[model samples]
Target: MRIAYRVETVRAAEQELIARLPDGALMQRAAAGLAAATAGMLGRVYGARVVVLAGSGDNGGDALYAGARLARRGAGVSAVLLAPDRAHPDGLAAFLRAGGRVADDPYDVLAAADLVLDGITGIGGHGGLRPDAVPVARAARGSNALVVAVDLPSGIEADSGEVLGEALHADATVTFGAYKPGLLVDPAHAYTGAVRLVDIGLEPHLPSVPDCEALQHADVAQLLPVPTGESDKYRRGVVGIVAGSARYPGAAVLAVAGALHGGAGAVRYVGPAADDVIARFPETLVSAGPPAKAGRVQAWVVGPGLGDAPGVEEVLAADVPVLVDADGLRGLDPAVVRDRAAPTLLTPHAGEAAALLGVSRAEVESARLRSVRELADRYGATVLLKGSTTLVADPGGRAPVRVNPTGTSWLATAGSGDVLSGLAGSLLAAGLTARDAGSVAAYLHGLSARHAANGAPLTASSVASSLTNAWRDVYA
Candidate 1:
């Protein structure tokens, strides 16, 4: 798992590490890593044109020190001092000693630079770039140089991942000590093109639980359900899907498509579109009656393309893990969902999430982390907020929220969410926790879409068909 901590946690950990080390030792360690990463990016340090955007804080110091190291290695280094007077005394002195001079014109140096190091702001910064630094940031981006950010890209909220205003877009970012929450999430994640972590002996001082985490392939493989010699269809787990309607029978087919590939022994579908589902997957057990009358199921996926069907209440009343999605989310009674005995996972896109939170769609999209957390807390259920950056938040809010790393724009297709609901519900039946099930589902769903698309326009059914390939690739 790739873990990320909040700014406060990172700062506390940094402080603890700083206390034990020599005064300049910690900064030097960070600077050394930064310089090494910069050198690697440049391919050769000698005769390279490097520009450092230096501000008033330790971020600037790291950049300045790294620039000095490059200067000593025969690189033509120039520092654009945003706060010339308040720059790190030792860092500036070293840079000057190494033949690195302050830029008389920032834009001129930036336009011809081979690489640009952004250090105008750090995790402590708020809102956006300072007025005086805006033009320089723009110039650096407008240049042909490969922009690299130190610790974090300037003008992004370190904790919330909000891009309040103009933010530097880095080709790559080298973060020190621990990964910040912003580096892992979006819209801030979009600014940080690629992220590399530099260990500065802060892990031992950091807390065990991070604020956010992204699961890697091996992690997902371990969580996936596997069959044994003693396992039967029922023992393997049965997922009951309550979805589709007379008007939208395709939803049932798509949901069943995903559920069948989710390691479930059997998929029992209960809805008005039973004929459509059965036609597509003859293996599916179909029931047109209420969900209570459906055969025994370990978990239930309710509400995909369900237009005012009576099964919502019936499924909710079932004593099984329930997943609510799509049209089923409309007019949902918070108290009923909150008071349920079984585990509940609510999968909502931005629009649906907005309805649940009584906020606008724009509000939910702009602040995805906050929106997901609030929905989880308010509904007292695990929430999978779907969008560019899918997030799974638990009701307790103590655990680190799971952020999905694998996703493509092709996943925005219609009926994609329906497939996800079924897939996640199956995982729940397979005995993964709500958090694990939701996150794993998202990971597979996104990966499947990418595979199916392969640079072409993808349909929801294609994504669903690609789930088997996705599952195999994870273990491979």
Candidate 2:
């Protein structure tokens, strides 16, 4: 697992190493790694034009020191000092001694450079680029040079992955110590093109668990439950779905359609659209009463196209793990969710999440990590914020946030979310914890959507059908 420590933690670790080792040793290691990375990019360091966008912190120090290494190798290295007065004295001295030049004009340097190293900000920065640094950032973006961020791209919140202000888009980001959360998540992630972790021997000092984690194929496959020879239908786990209404039969069918592919032993669907659900999926056990009366289910998925229906209250009253999505999230009773005996999961897109918080959709989108955590804390449940980067946060605060990386814009089709609700609910029924269930289902759902689309338009049914292949791919 790739663990990402908080900035403070990383700072502490750096200090500890510095205290033990010789002074400036760690920075030199970081600088050397960066020089090697940049050299590889230029093919040959000699005669290569390299520009380092230097800031006031150790990030700039790293860039300058790396520039010195390149200069020693006969490269034409220039530093665009964002804060020349506050720059690291040792780094500046080393660069000057190695025959590096300081660029008076950032645009001129960017125009002629083969590669640009963004050292303007590291994990310490909170907001976007400072006003003085903005022009250089823009110039790098528009230039022909291949931009590489030294630690993290400036103007991005390293912890939350939110782009605070104007950010430089990097062709590749060479991060030190460990993978920061921002590089793996969205908004900021979009600017961080390709991320490479330059191990500076800091992992042992970091936490065992990360602030958030993105699943790999093996991790997802391991988390997926498999049936035993003696397992019966009920033993495998039963998923109870309460969805649809007279006005939205398709919602019920789509939800059940996803549930059918779940490794669950059986699916018991209860709601007003029982007849329609049965018509589409004859394999489902359809019932006409409340979810509690539907009898023995490991998990319950409520509210797809529930349409202000009367039965939602009944389903919400169930003791089993419940997943609320779509219309079910509309004017949801926080008390009902908070008081539930079993774990509850809420899957809401930005619009629905905005409604829950009484905030604008743009606000929710801007700070998605904070929004998901806030929602999970407020409702005392798990929240899966569905969007460009789906984030799953647990209320208990025991685990790191799970960011869904295998998502595609094609998954934006109608009824796609209903399928996710069912898939996650089934995972809950199969005995995974709320956090695991939500994250696992998201991974599978995203993979299924990609498989179904395959660069073409797809419907809800196709996504459901693609689950088998998705599952096989995970196992394979």
Candidate 3:
């Protein structure tokens, strides 16, 4: 698993580590890692052109010191001082001693640079770039050089993952000490290309719990349901699905398809599309009327094309874990969900999430981390904010938010979310907590989509059918 800490936690840890080390030792550690990363990107440090976009603080110092190291290796290193008087004094002296020259014109050197170290702003800088630095930041991005951001991509809210106003775009980001939340979550995550973490001996000082966590294959393998000798159709767990309408029966088909592969012992589907579902998947237990009349089930999945459905309230009243999605998510009573004895998982895309929050879609998209957490807190349920980056946030903000790393843009096809809703709901039936069910389902859902597509267009059915491959890939 990959864990990310908040800015405050990381800063506290850095300060503690710095106090224990000799004077200037901490900065030297960062500079050495930064220099090594730069060299690796450049391949041949000798006869290469390197430019440092230096600002006014320790972040700028890291760049200047790195530039000095490059200069010693015979790279023609130049510094573009956004704050000439405010640049790191010791770092500047060291750069000059190593034959690094301050650039007469920022644009001139950036145009010919082989690599640009973006140290204009650090984790502390937020609300975008200063007015004076915007043009140079743009020029560096427009250049052919590989832009490597120090710590963060600058102008991103390190804690909230919001990219306000203007921020520099990097080809890669070399972060030190610990991973910050901004590097892992979008929309700031989009600005940070590939991220490389440099250890500066701050791990021992940091807390165990992180702000957010991204699960890997091995982590997910442990969570997958494996049937034991005592396990049967009922013992493995049964998932009840209340989905589809007379108008849209395809949703029922797709949802059942996903649930069938979701490690559930049996799927009891109760809706208007029973005939359609039974026709597609004959093994499904079909029924009419409310969810309570569908026999016993460990969990319920409500609303995926359930237009003006009447079964949502009935499912909510049950003492089993419930997953609400699509049309079922509309007009949800926060008090009802909050007071429930069983866990509830809410899956909503940007538009659906916005409607629930009573905000605009753009607002939710811009601040995804905040939006997911807010939705989770408001309803007192687990929220899976589905988009380019799928985030599952637990209620009350006690545990770290889980980010799905396997998401593919190809999973944007219609009805894909319905498939995800069923898969997650089935996991809920299989005894996974709301948080675990949502995150694990998202991980597999994304991986399955990638397997089905393989760089081509894929339908929601293809994603559902590829679950076996995804499972094998995980177990392998």
TM values, all candidates: 0.99, 0.95, 0.98
- Tens digits of lDDT, candidate 3, 20-128: 9899999999999999998999999999999999999999999999999999999999999999999999999999999999999999999999999999998899899
Report how far residue 60 has shifted in candidate 2, in Å: 0.4
Count of residue pairs whose backbone atoms collide, per candidate: 0, 0, 0
lDDT of 2: 0.88
* Clash pairs, model 3 backbone: none
Q: Which stretches of candidate 1 lie over 4 Å from their true place?
A: none
Q: Write the per-residue lDDT of candidate 2 for residues 1-476, one digit (tens) a residue.
A: 55566788788788877888888999999999999988888898889999989999899999999999999999999999999899989999999999999988888989999999999987899779999889889999999999999899999989888997888899999999988788877888899887888888887777787788888899998899899999988878899998998988899998998888978789999888888888888889988876767878988898999888766677777777889999889889889889888899999999999999999999999888889989998899999999999999998667799888786788888999999888888898989988989888899999998998899888888999899999999998
Worst 10 residues of 3 by lDDT: 154-163
lDDT of each: 0.92, 0.88, 0.94
Q: Given candidate 1, what's the lDDT at residue 209?
A: 91
List where candidate 3 sits over 4 angstroms from the true fold.
Answer: none
lDDT of 3 at 154: 75
